[model samples]
Target: MGQAGATFPQSLWDPSFLFLTSGTSEGGSREGLWGHVDQLNRTLAQHTEDIAHLRDDLLDCRAQLAEQLEKNLLFPQISTSLLSVALMYMEAQRKPDPEKAIAGGTGD
Candidate 1:
């Protein structure tokens, strides 16, 4: 075929390129592949451990938030009950007892 019509130049098919395509390059050796695989395994193991720790931390945080939410929900009711009791006591004290007032006693 004419050079002008060739898809690629013949120089591009060098021996090093052939070796790489044939899985015979330095990085494609058995030992190199095994080393790469080992590194990948180590990284995956570390990531798994980190993910587990994060999951546990998330669970703890959710539980703490739930407890705080429960406490927050109860506080208003508790405060309202206490206020009602205080107001009732104050109302009772504000009105004088006629008998006690006539007996020269401070009725409030």
Candidate 2:
């Protein structure tokens, strides 16, 4: 039971699935992603689909990780060294709001 060469798909690291938000996406973590997803349908209509697609990919990635972990099973310490995963935001571009920056520059 020492198959330690398991692999995860590239979709897990796809840059398109990431975005930069002023606030943490903890709302999504709180079982409210779909609830608030529709709110973007009117203004950022495209993001609605993007968000949904990203959610699907994330779920798929989790499933794949589980499957891979099963295949890579071994002694506890060995298995831990066999697989290391890192989840991170892409931080695509730093498009700051000039008006907000200029207006709020002085305050703490």
Every candidate's lDDT: 0.80, 0.55
User: How much does candidate 2 score in TM-score?
Assistant: 0.29
C-alpha-based local distance difference test score of model 2: 0.55
| RMSD of model 1 against the true structure | 9.9
lDDT per residue for candidate 2 within 53-86, as digits (tens), equals 9999999999999988876665565655544321
Tens digits of per-residue lDDT for model 1, 37-62: 69999999999999999999999999
- List where candidate 2 sits over 4 angstroms from the true fold: 1-43, 74-108
Give the residue spans of candidate 1 off by over 4 A.
Answer: 1-27, 96-108
The deviation in Å at residue 42 for candidate 1 is 0.8
RMSD to truth, every model = 9.9, 36.4
Number of colliding residue pairs in model 2: 0
